[model samples]
Target: MYAIVRTGGKQYQVATGDTLRVEKLKGEVGETVELSDVLLVADGENIRVGVPAVEGAKVVAKIVEQGKAKKVLVFKKKKRKGYRVMRGHRQMFTALSIQEIM
Candidate 1:
C-alpha cells in the first residue's frame, strides 16, 4: 500500500520501507515521527481520499539522518555596468524511512 502525506507544508507519496528526504523537522536520528496529514491512501484498485485529509489515517516514519542538500549557486550580472553578484545556498533536510502506514 501507498499513501500521500503532508509535512512541512509539502506533500509526498510514500510507501512502506521507502526512504526520502523532506524539509527540516524537529527530531534527532532514530526518532519516530508520525505524519498525520494523509491525503490519500491506495491499495490495489481501492483508493481512499480526503477532503483535506484522511481521518484516522497516519504514516509512521523514522528519522535516519539529517543534513543539508548540495550547494546551489545564484549568479547575477548587469551588462555594461560591470556589476556582479554571486551567492550559494544549501537547504536543510531530514531523511526518513517509512516504517508503517495505518
Candidate 2:
C-alpha cells in the first residue's frame, strides 16, 4: 500500500521500505515516528482521499539519518558599484524509512 502523509510542513508520497529525506525532525536514528496527517491511501485498486486528513490513517517510519544537505551559495552584486555579497547555507534534513501504512 502507499500513503500520502504530511510532516515537517511538507507532504510526501511513501510506501513500505521506501526512504526519503525531509525537514529535520527531532529524536535519534532508529527512532520510530508516526505520520498521522495522512492525506490519502491506496491499496491495490482501492483508493481513499481525505478532506484535509484521514482519521485513523497513519504512516509509520524510522529515522535513518540526521544530516545537512549540500551547501547552496547565494551571491549578490550591484553593477559598477563594486558592492558584492556572498553567503552559503546547508539545510538540515532527516532521512526516514517508511515501515508501514495503517
Candidate 3:
C-alpha cells in the first residue's frame, strides 16, 4: 500500500520500506514519527481519499538521519554601480523510513 502524507508544508507519496528526505523535523535517529495528515491511501485497486485528511489514517515512520543539505549560493551584481551581494544557505532536512500505514 501507498500513502500520501503531509509534513512541513509539503506532501509526499510513500510506501512501506521507502526512504525519503523531508523538511526538518524534531527527534533523533531511530525515533518513531507518526504522520496523521494522510491525504490519500491506495492498495492495489482500492483507493481512499480524504476531504482534508483521512480520519484515523496515519503513516508510521522512523527517523533514520538528520542533516543539512548542500549549500546554495546566491549572488547578485549591479553593473557599473559597483554593487554586489553574495549569500549561501543550507536547508536542514530529516530522512525518514516509512514503516507502515494504518
**Tens digits of lDDT, candidate 3, 17-57:** 99999999999999999999999999999999999999899
Q: For candidate 1, lDDT tens digit of each residue in 1-102?
A: 999999888999999999999999999999999999999999999999999999999999999999999999999999999999999999999999999999
TM-score of decoy 1 = 0.96
Give the local distance difference test score of model 1: 0.97
Instruction: List the pairs of residues colliding in candidate 1.
Output: none
Worst 10 residues of 2 by lDDT: 3-12
What C-alpha lDDT, on a 0 to 100 scale, does residue 69 get in candidate 3? Answer: 98
My TM-score estimates for the predictions, one after another, are 0.96, 0.96, 0.97
Ranking by lDDT: 3, 1, 2
Q: What is the lDDT of candidate 2?
A: 0.94
**lDDT on C-alpha atoms for all candidate structures:** 0.97, 0.94, 0.97
> Per-candidate RMSD vs. true structure?
0.8, 0.8, 0.7
